[model samples]
Target: MKPDTTAPLTFGMLVFDEVEVLDLGGPFEVFSTAGRLARTAADEPLLRVLTVAPTVRTVRARGGLTIVADHTLDEDPPFDVLVIPGGVTTAVERDEKVVDWLARRRRTSALTFSICTGAFLLAATGALDNRPATTHWEDQEELARRWPDVRLCTDVRWVDDGDIVTSAGISAGIDASLHVVARLFGEQLARRTARQMEYLWTDTRA
Candidate 1:
């Protein structure tokens, strides 16, 4: 689905215990910064980002960083995009509630994006079945083994399969997020956002 360019697109990022710090922070920084750069006197920011979790509680990230979610799954907050960040996802992948929630949300969201091993969670929901996707290089074999239906792409930093996008590892998420910004808005704005963040955008078409 094409995003409504006249208004801000709401991005709901999923957070859970043991989520990787940079996996969540990198894309958060990119989207937030891009929103700021896209804002003007007469318009709201191009995007609105918020954190969501299964419950309303403080989540401990991979490196002991704690984050409080802005919304809970019980609230069923509306969003145009869904962001899933990867870390220790063994438990999360086993969570039927969260996995089911993702499946339901994916149908209505304009985009569903995953970072690193977060692709596993998406795959659990059957979102990546028969779809081109990539993840952290270390986990590619496991992902392919676990979900044989998924078409794994090893060489690319990110794969954008229409509505679902997946990126490799932590830092690569930033590049993928910038690509999303460019896809939704324009490359000029994305370049400016990357420049503002002092990030060298490595790929625009990946």
Candidate 2:
């Protein structure tokens, strides 16, 4: 589905305990930076990024970093894009609440983005079933083994399957997020956003 560029798109990022810092932070930075660069004195930003968690409590991310969510699952805040970042996802995978919430959101959101093993959570929601997807290289085999229905793509930074986009690993999320920026806005805006962040964006074709 094409994004309505006339207004800002809301990006809801899912965060949880043990979540990988770079996985979440990378995309957050990309979308937030893109929004800032796209904004003008007469117009609003191009995107609005929010952090959503199972609850609005302090989340202990990987490396002992703590984060507070802006919204929770129960609030059911609306978003145009859903960002799922990877980390130690065993507990998240086991949480039926999160899985169900993702499944529901995937149906309504304009785009669903998975970073690293975050693909596993999307897979749990069956969003990746029979879809071309990728994940952190080390976890590819396990993803394939568990979700035989997923058409796994190896040796790629990310896979863009229309509404769903999956990235290889932590830092790769930045690349994929920039690609999304280019897709939604334009390459010019995306390039400017990358330049503003001093990030060398590797734009890959979908």
Candidate 3:
């Protein structure tokens, strides 16, 4: 893995008040590590990971962990991959501004991804319409009731529908990120990265 100077993949994390901290941090860890490790063997860094919120300020997490976003929604440039992590999933799903951003950003990004209850927000964007996806299993029934357009899958860590992808809760975010790594640097590299990170994920190849 070398510095891919041509087109750097921008990884954007969408944060809202009370967002689950783990969902936001998990994939960020994987991709940032991948970028650093790749840089070690290549010319330039491969990822630009940043946290984004309504405005760059301290937003409290679900359990009262405060974080400072790197940029506000309007200030941040476009991202190749936008990750929406679940917080108060229902609250996020019902937010008008969050829905609007996701809808607009989906048009620009190569990939839009969600973790845990974040799938609820993605479904709100109508991006997952007619596509198979999954979220935290606890939210499936409610999600199905609310967004009937998405086909829910029960037995996988993640479902990637080309432009849109969703994963199960918490640690499943690690699997989803590894899926991105697999796509970017090949499966072997992804596996190596997973091993180096000491992450556990579903082995679809098995």
Candidate 4:
């Protein structure tokens, strides 16, 4: 793995048991591919992507896909962007250490994003306390009921509130990642990244 200094931005994707693979993997592919393409173009890589967990162990995703974390909380590198992916929210949300770690990381991270029910974890950190956020539509009611202070936007594919971004569900994460690329790099680069993935880029919300 490349050191954090090799890339302009470092993205940390949080993972745990039952995490939605696509939620983290989609963005991972986007950012990593974007970086690779940028290097090919004789430009510096835009971002470095890696997965981090509470421990350096394998986690069984919701669908039974086992994934080994790239780093543990204690040894993970600093990240400019922190991506909290949704899946099996109860376990992660209830973990105070994880929430606290997120709170601490937010202070130095340039951007933080949540995909699907991952918003639950982000919200648990009090970062989204009074801000507008969106999550998987299926959990919107529960999220609203639990965190009344957060304004829930259920009608959009994703919500971008400056430094914090949240996407509706699985596939939407890819779109949100492209938007991040556009914001950090440029529109042309974002388009190119999407095209390389053969993904349709729709600037529906952002």
* Winner of 1 and 4 under TM-score: 1
TM-score of each: 0.96, 0.96, 0.90, 0.92
C-alpha lDDT of all candidate models, in order: 0.91, 0.91, 0.80, 0.85
Count of clashes in candidate 2: 0
- Judged by whole-model lDDT over C-alpha atoms, candidate 4 comes out at 0.85
> How good is model 2 by TM-score?
0.96
What TM-score number comes out for model 3? 0.90
lDDT of 3: 0.80
Per residue, candidate 1 scores C-alpha lDDT tens digits across 1-206 of: 55565778899999999999999999999999988878644588978799998876689999799899998899889999999999999998888999999999989998999999999999999989989999999999999999999999997889999999999999999999989888887889889999999988997534
Candidate 4 segments whose C-alpha is farther than 4 A from its true place: 1-7, 40-44
* Model 3: per-residue Cα lDDT over 25-64, one tens digit each: 8888888877776652345666768888875567988889
Q: For candidate 4, give the lDDT of residue 121.
A: 92
Clashing pairs in 3: none
Pull out the clashing pairs in model 4.
Answer: 86-118
lDDT of 4 by residue, 1-206 (tens): 22233446778989999999899789889999988777533367767788888865688888899999888888857778899999888987888888888888877788898999999998898888899999988899999999999999987889999989999989888888898888877788889999999999876783
